[model samples]
Target chain A: MDDATRVEVAASLLEAYRTRQPIEPLVEKYAGLELDDAYAIQQHQVQAWLGEGRVIQGHKVGLTSGAMQRQMGVDQPDYGVLRDDMFYPEDAPVPAGIFLAPRIEPEIAFVLSRDLTGPGVTVAEAAAAVDFVLPALEIIDSRIRDWKITILDTIADNASSGGVMLGSTPTRLSDVDLRLAGCNLYGNGALVATGAGGAVLGSPLLSLAWLANTVGRHGVTLRAGHVVLPGSVTPAQPVRPGDTWTAQFAGIGSVTARFGQETA
Target chain B: MAAHEAGHLLDPGATVGPIDLRTAYAVQAEGLALRLAAGERLVGWKIGYTSAAMRAQMRVDAPNFGPLTDRMLLAGGEPVSTALTQPRVEPEILLILGDDLPGGSDRDRVAHAVGEARGALEVVDSVWRDYRFRLEDNTADGSSAAHAVIGPLLPAGVDLAEVGVTLIGPDGERSEATGAAAFGHPLDALGWLADALAAQGSRLRAGDIVLTGGLTAAVPLPSGARIRADFAGAGEVSVRREAAVPPSRTPADTAETGT
Candidate 1:
């Protein structure tokens, strides 16, 4: 793809994200677009957000598990940058109008006390770098209309990352065996989905390590004090207005997000 | 611990896990001491993770530095062979000091102390498996120091605040960046390194060559790949990767190896 078109597509996606409007799949317009082109487009959008004063809070690893990858119709996982504006406080009302078609997935978030970089980072090394871990609910909303996305399309859409709500309680790694940390998602007090941390690439640490090493190849570092959201433990559940969801994790704590009525 | 692992091309395990920044640096110093005992001469230092984006990602308020040795310096315009586990290249400005500047030197003094600046490429290879590790792991691993190639040096007075850098590989993969990508100005990296060294009881001396942080993200260099970096005004440098050589068995190789 030519540089100008790349920039234009990125600008259009950025506009769609900012205005909370969904657009047609980019594959329809940019034929034979490769993964590199998708990432380039994503980077341009991220750069645009940075130019607009949006601070990078952290990053997210998406589609790490076999189920998520299968559900997403891709063989490999993808990553996305998280902005501070994308965060909603625990138990806070999530505005429905700000998203196109929102879905929620339970995840474990790692807060690092030191910088982590890789091309060769191991799971043990990644686990040892964690300052703490918390339960999180990731609200993923694809900018592509109807979410008809290929790997390239989703990657270009920032891995469908929309909003993140983090639990307040932080548990140290020594206090919890992440692989055994079971999680149950409840909507309006009714159980909807069940999973465990092991669902995320056998362990969330492995997922985090995978993200660190993959992004590190592109010259990105997972910094100290940064919060990294590993892939979902449970499949994403579609969110609707007036729906209140809670995710309880064993050993780790629980978090809740309430959706408000959509406003015009 | 890092020295032991790097010397043997081994991965960190029980002997050394992800450590705190302070412990990591201490381990790095110990590794450097071992290298010194083995007859490797320290030429200068290499500062890394200086860009705001990188620093922010690493959650570090400042950049980190590692020792540069004589053996790691490659001749300009030559084919460089590396046995590093996984290697990547970055374009940067090499600061060759003409005068001594200890810690606490101001910007003007730092500018005056520099003898010349050259376009350079640094080969960074992490010993940590999968290139994943904490700050201390990187610090202890000599900040992923592997090899460096220096270009023709330009006068110290050249305005480098906005020098453009473009790295191109034989396969036509390209990445472009500016000097500002390295801590706003490359000299700022020099100053940061000086201060950081001073805090650790070391000092930047004359004849030391400092490689400022990468202006662009590191690019993987496969065997037989020719890489060229063009630095606007400062000139250009190129290096071709030679075919890999099979590893020879050593005493360390026969010993207990950690993954």
Candidate 2:
């Protein structure tokens, strides 16, 4: 994709989000959306949103799990930025109609106390920067129609992030061995998926470390007071109106996301 | 230099921000000092643009040369370890000196100093945007040198002028040339190199490796490209570029060059 197409695609994706009308996968139109082109398109939209008075909240890592990596045939994971509007109160009901096709995943979220800067940060170094960890439910909604997306499509769509719901408990890294922590996800009073923390790059800390190094090349710093969702520990399951999803970690806390039947 | 090697395109003309050859050499010396500071040893030198057509295209009167350090060598078939701004490969005959070549030596003495000859590939990258610059700019940019990949060494008797070179690209594209492309004979390039260096009060030393000028037009080496160079009667050498990363993503890279 060239300069013109990047700007054009960014505008289309932004319009789709505001209109609650998901557009076709960008890959269909661009046909040759390279990693750099997709990143450029994503940044164009990010800048536009910032101009509209949106605040950047954090970042997200996607395809960290071996299964996702293998499925996508990519050796490393892709990333996206998160904004202040993406976070929602855990106690309030989220409007289902706001998202075109939302899905839910459990993640180990890191809230940083120290800025993590690196093009070469180690997992040990990342461990030193964390303030606390929380159970998080990432409500991934695609601006691309039907969630049919390639890696480029998802990356340009801000890693398909819609909203974030966090658990109340804030535990330190030393308090829990997340690699051994198992998670059970529930939806509408029924079990939907089960996974362990090891599913996300052996441990969520490794994902955090990778995220820092990956973005650091672009001059981005994972700053203090920022939230980082390493990746989903389990495959994302679809969302429906009136559905309620809760993710419970064995040693960590649990986060619940209640959805409205439909927007008025 | 580090930024340029990372595929960062700098200003269009002079890379070192200096225009004169003296300043160009000084700027090059500054970069060499940094390499030495980082514990790299000077191993050899590489000459570029020896072909008549190349010199004409670049509008230069003579071939340019620059120092080759241990850090700039790569093993044959090994992938290029760093991202480069406009990386291209040029095939050459490498001369490993068994004895020093004294200043103003005749072609006989120059030929005698060669211990052996080998087929080699030099991966060249430009620091200036689009390689649009004066010869001084490229000279200061270390003759646009990134890495050298060597092939199997052959005894001193390999044919010089008539030796044929066949280059195959990763996608099976082919380019053909011969040793005569460099000043009608590879040995003349070596002789010119000695005179060029002697002008700067530097003389060839024993164990010094010298890369004669490119045999054919350079070809672009994209991500995962594997380029093979076959030098008739000497040996064959090849190089591969690592799988693609988004531009400007990878950090400092070290190691590549074959025996």
Off by over 4 Å in 1: B1-259
Give the 10-residue window scoring lowest on summed lDDT in candidate 1 chain B.
B1-10
- A1-264: candidate 2 lDDT, tens digit per residue: 679989999999999988988899888877788999988888999999899999998899898876677787787888888899889899999988898888999988999999999899999899999999999999998999988888899889888888899999999998876664556677886555555566677678999999999889999899999999999877889988888999877557789999999852
True contacts kept of each: 0.00, 0.00
The residue-by-residue lDDT of candidate 1 on A1-264, one tens digit each, is 977888988988888877878889999988968888999988998898899899998999888876567776777788999999999987569998888899999898999998899979998889888999989999999999998988888899998999999999999999976764557677887656555676677678988899899999999999999999998876789999989998877668789999998752
Tell me the fnat of candidate 1.
Answer: 0.00
Model 2, B90-172: lDDT tens digits are 88888899998867888999889988888899988878777766778888888888888988674356456545566677776
Q: How accurate locally is residue B166 in candidate 1, as Cα lDDT from 0 to 100? A: 59
Best by the lDDT measure: 2
